[model samples]
Target: MVRYFDAELETMPWTDVLAWQAERTATFVRGLVDRSPFHTEKLAGVGVPTGVVRDLAFLEDLPFTTKAEVRESQSTRDPALPLGRHQAVPRGAIHQVLSSSGTTGQPVLYGLTATDVEMWADVIATAFWTAGVRPDDIAGHLVGLPGVAGGLPYADGFRRIGAGLAWIGGWPTERVVELMISLGVDAVLATSSFGTYLTDRCEDLVGIPAKDIGVRKMLGGGEPGLGQPEIRQKIVEGWGLDVLSEIMGLGDVLACLWAECEDGGGMHFCGQRAVAVELVDPATGEPRAWEEGVRGEAVYTTFAREATPALRYRSRDHVLVTATSCACGRTSPRIRCVGRTDDMLIYKGMNVFPSSLRDVVLQGFADDVQPSIRVWKDGSDQVRFDGPIPMDVEASDDLAPDRYREVAAAIAADVRARLQVRVAVTVVAPGSMPRTAYKTPLVHVRETDDDQ
Candidate 1:
């Protein structure tokens, strides 16, 4: 337990890591069911025995907690009451508070103690180190807000390495370029797409060539583009950078910060905290084959997550998990996040993923154009996809009114040839659809105000 953050975990003999995990699993399980009412009720409902679950096979003995279950707990449960006397901490012990996005509905709030934040910073720093993140570099941040959990711990990772950073919170493209040149930023903590876009566009606006702007490192989450190999390579080469590492993280669960190495197989998740990566079939809850090519839902578990522990936590992401040792020598379990289960659709008998179509379309489009996606409901059980068209190319081209038709035709042709399903494509004018300053909206369609 004391060696949790030690880098040796990455290279530890399989025998040792498993033994350590098994030893801690029982104690960790006891703490959750004993203290947190949320988990107590959940564990009981799911038929988790009151006794310790000692074996990895017994992990299946516990019922899985879905996102809906967590949301329901947040909605109905008051976390502060603490069983009258046996509280984990006195109410005033909380050092910080964070809120969920609330885009879907009401925001869920959480309290983080000082110890939790330290553990967060330390574990993630180790993750950055595993990906060859160094203390000598300078970093630029594109994180949006305090509550979003995007940037602070990332910056904290850099800071732990004794690196300096330009805290340029998510801003306009023009502002980012201006600061990049002014500050001579070397590394970026941003979305892979935005990082690529800035690299492609910075030469003209920043005075410094995008490749020479000194930007090298990229750390991002909240999207799947970082896991795309071709897109990852394009971003790295486009910037003339050697390192294009992608770290997987979650706001609610901070301990899953894993970094993708140059091999690009799957990211080595942070074991500094007790994160267990389980690949499973979303429907049957049966374990999926964790081979190189097969994809499955990423079920992540962590005992070291003291603030909010998640057991058998389903990430909603479909990923490729390879437990095999990497050629690069790191032995930590790694995952290639393929796509979100929610984002995949079976349309006209074609198994389609927005990310799958996205990786192809973004590769084909010109530099300045942005892509969009729309899913139309079909007969209550189906969701058909539309558009991977670049905004300006399809909407502002010389063809004018012929633009949308041309785009739809072109997409249908591509789909027929590659995907075998014809999808309608509609392109909006550049910036015709809007997004909040901090976030990018990938799915948008022509919907009337009355449609809501």
Candidate 2:
């Protein structure tokens, strides 16, 4: 059965939704001008009108918000404005301050007001409900430390919805499995790689197959694995779970903003009332219509925020938007993240994402290759490469050492045939590559020949 946390907002008419967004956006812009000195200075000559922004086209006139800009704002150490001018609320009113995961570059700090906290909880709760998590289910959250931005919101949202949460962030795979058995956990929250890692270790740790565990639904995010058909199928078949849903969000904008419903469609925009989304051509910076198969970078603007509100915040996450109504009866748009713009590699006039390459390898090799993989370039800071990119694949335990060369050759040939990228695949023994509790790094570059 399909359940909605906020049925009125989730089921609101499409036209009404746009109207609400326009009204809220206008108010939010006005508040930014009044409360945020950084936005006030940045938007000086943009000349945005005062009233309701009835059309999204007006947004193009305003300057785009980038991660660099936010980082710069946070770096300013003026005593009067220690939290940066982008902060909208007073320091006393700030309820919580969080930092980005710093996976790409320097981590930016964000503060949330009391009201912003509630809104964040609501957005996460709606995402959880859409992912088929109910109040009666015990959710085991596998995320980073509680202080990180990615995991804390899930804990708060689960508590808000009256679901029992087992905080197992630092637990080993064996302990996690043991807890699932003892606590009767039916729902789990984890990144795709962590889920795969736990599944791979289940039998060795607990003396039972992963499928024997009682987890019914798996909520995967923090990376691109769950959305890929090959990776998702591996988790579904490996864990013996009935449903798998993907949840996506940004720390700078909102957490758990989009989530997949039970029908397994792409993640729906669950933060319709609180956030407005736009798509723009990554190369040309031109706005694109939110239509099926139209791909671009995601830009977000928050309407009802106090501590740190952003306008036209560039997410750098390339996605294809779908306007088709989902089977779950949500009128909001859905998105499938294609790749991060920073992670794109251009080789011989073709663009490739490492995640896509990993998916192709998984689909072709199945159980022969372990989920752990690393794509490497010969030189450091090299964005573009020509032929025969280097990759290291961890061979499964059951694969014989004599067959390593054959398996590596097959994987390289499959990648060439399917993804049109040439790669030199090296099959290493199991546990050669490092495993991560958070998002896995798909690309690794050796700084110098000596290091290699």
Candidate 3:
């Protein structure tokens, strides 16, 4: 039988959820207007009555909260408010603080009250349970970066679910492997790339493939690409996993919001109580309905938060709704994150994500190339490539150096035929490209000799 962390909320009727969210949002907005200076002014500027919203209908009227705005608010350095002008509670009430990875810009700090911390733990536990983490399993965590939500907050969530936890991240890979084997870790929590990286490292270090290390389950998060078919196939085969589920969240909102169930076509909405989620056109800021095949950016309102309450926060993540109903009995919609808006590239008016190109190369040319690739950019800010985009792919171990040109030609042709976009493919030697234990970036800016 399929199990849920909270069956009542997970299987609630969609119409009933709408009513619950509306009521919670109204009360949450009133508190935000009274306590948060940034939100109060923003809501008033949009002509919300008394600078407070009374219902979910006003969500569209409320201005979006952007990362730039949040960063600017904190830049003020007001002595009274360390968390920023948007902080909904006093500094003393903040029980803990976490930060973003700052991949796009400066790392933004988030505050959580004691109660908020408990709520986040529950949210993450619920997500993990949905992803098939059982209480009896010993989960070896590889997401222990300091002060990030993926670090301690996730560890707490693991324990809350009554699972055996070993916080093994931030250590050297050799040490991580040693401990996993010694402790007989059967389940793993890691970034998607790390899962693939560990597969290779295990064989190289211990002369044993990761599959032999006894790990039967893997939950990948903290980055995209885990849901891609090629990546998923690699990880599942590499680790010999019984189940592989993808979990996604943003630091600006709840840490673990969407999780894939065992029936998994995509990750179901798992943060309904803490966040009121909306799908909207990224360009037009217009709301989109939650229907299968619908594509849009995700926007979140943290209506149940205390330390910091986000009002209509715009998350630049672009996703496609894959299913409206699951055999697993989840009533919420399921989604697969397509790509981030900032990571999108335009080639001759056609939009392309680097992850998509990676998928085509790995899936179509698996024998000729390694699973790694890097897209070369003209500059750091270049998003539009006028010519065939420059990309480097590593050759497979069995592929000879002299045959690189043939493989390159085949890959370029395949990418063009599949994605309908031109890519300049250069097959490099195996291990020539960089790999990371954390998130792996697909794009690399050309470095000048002077900089080198």
TM-score of each: 0.81, 0.92, 0.95
TM-score rank, highest first? 3, 2, 1
Each prediction's whole-model lDDT (CA): 0.62, 0.83, 0.87
Q: Give the Cα error of residue 359 in candidate 2, in Å.
A: 2.9
Work out candidate 3's RMSD over C-alphas.
Answer: 2.2
Worst 10 residues of 3 by lDDT: 46-55
Instruction: Kindly give the stretch of ten consecutive residues in candidate 1 with the minimal lDDT sum.
Output: 387-396
TM-score-better candidate, 2 vs 3: 3
Deviating ranges (above 4 Å) for candidate 3: 45-57, 400-403
Q: List, residue by residue over 15-107, the lDDT tens digit for candidate 2.
A: 678777887787777667778789989888777767656766677888889988999998888665557878887788888888888887987
Better of 1 and 3 by lDDT: 3
lDDT of 2 at 302: 89
Candidate 1, pairs of clashing residues: none
lDDT of 1 by residue, 1-452 (tens): 22223557766865566566764765666677776667777676454444544445556767676666666666543457321221244566666666666654566555557787777777777777666566676677777676656656666766776667678876777787678668877777777657656655666665656687667766655567766655666677778777777777765567337787667666876753556666788768898755666677877666666655677888777777755567766666677777766566665556777676665555554342344344444333335544332222233333345456666566556655787665555565554544332344444444457676
The top-ranked prediction according to TM-score is 3
- Residue 405's C-alpha lDDT in candidate 3? 96
